[model samples]
Target: MTVKDIATLLDAKIICCEDSLGRELHAACGADMMSDVLAFVKDQSVLLTGLCNPQVIRTAEMMDMVCIVFVRGKLPDENMIELAIERNIPLLSTKHRMFTACGLLYSNGLHGGATN
Candidate 1:
């Protein structure tokens, strides 16, 4: 699905890079730990995370993630937002908790691409 589809599915607010809403993503990873994300992320995927910090943006950029969804109604600070915008990554925020948000996207066909 596209980033816009994920935004609609999670009832998330598009925080930046609205133009990237059309980008297609085949998978998702939900994590609060950047280390796990770095170890498991797949190609052009979405990251559903609860950690609201600049490191999250940096990790997503390094992983080449399609976008980031901040769960549990958490929003990043201005610095993180600026970093995301500079990286040309779309950021979304949702009121759903991490598990629920990840489940919603998974149920809609976005799978976790990491393999054991």
Candidate 2:
């Protein structure tokens, strides 16, 4: 799926990189802990998290993630936006709880990341 499809599926707001809505996304992983995301994610993926901090953006950058989805209606503050902007990662937020959001995307064919 593309970023626009994710935005539509989760009712998310695009916070930056509006031009990236056309980018294809192959996988997703939801997490609140940056460490776990760093250790687990393995693909050109998008992150779904409730953490809403600058560190989340940093982690996404380190993992080469293309987008971030903030769950539970959480919004990234200015610092986080700056990080995403600097990293060229698109940011989005959705009101759905993490599980429901992940499930919806997964059911639609977005896998979690590669394990090998």
Candidate 3:
């Protein structure tokens, strides 16, 4: 699905990279632990997380993720937004909790990447 589709599906607020909303993302992974994301995520372009920090953006960058969905209405600070913008990753905020958000995407045909 496209980034715009995910935003629409979740009713999320797009915080940056609106220009890239047309980008297509085939997979998603939801996690609060950066370590787990770093260790296990593979080829997932969208990240769904409750963690609202700069390191989350960094972790997404390391995983080559193109978009981030902040669950439970969590919003990243300016620094985090700057980092995401610099990395060309779109940030989205959703009122849904982590589990609900993940389920929404999954039920809509967004699958998780393979785990090691």
- Report the number of the highest-TM-score candidate: 3
**Candidate 3 structure lDDT:** 0.94
TM-score of each: 0.95, 0.96, 0.97
Worst 10 residues of 3 by lDDT: 107-116
Better of 1 and 2 by TM-score: 2
lDDT tens digits, residue span 1-116, model 2? 99999999999999998888898999899889988887767884899999987889989998888899999999998888888888889999999999999999999999886863
Residue pairs in collision within model 1: none
lDDT per residue (tens digit) for residues 4-116 in model 3: 99999999999999998999999999999999999888999999999888999999998899899999999999999899889999999999999999999999999986876
The window of 10 residues in a row where model 2 has the poorest summed lDDT is 36-45
Task: Kindly report which residue stretches of model 2 are placed more than 4 angstroms away from their true locations once superposed.
Answer: none
Query: What are the lDDT figures for the candidates, one per model?
Result: 0.90, 0.90, 0.94
lDDT of 1 by residue, 1-116 (tens): 99999999999999999989999999888889999888766574888889998999999999888899999999989999899989999999999998889888889888877553
Better of 2 and 3 by lDDT: 3
Candidate 1 weakest ten by summed lDDT:
36-45
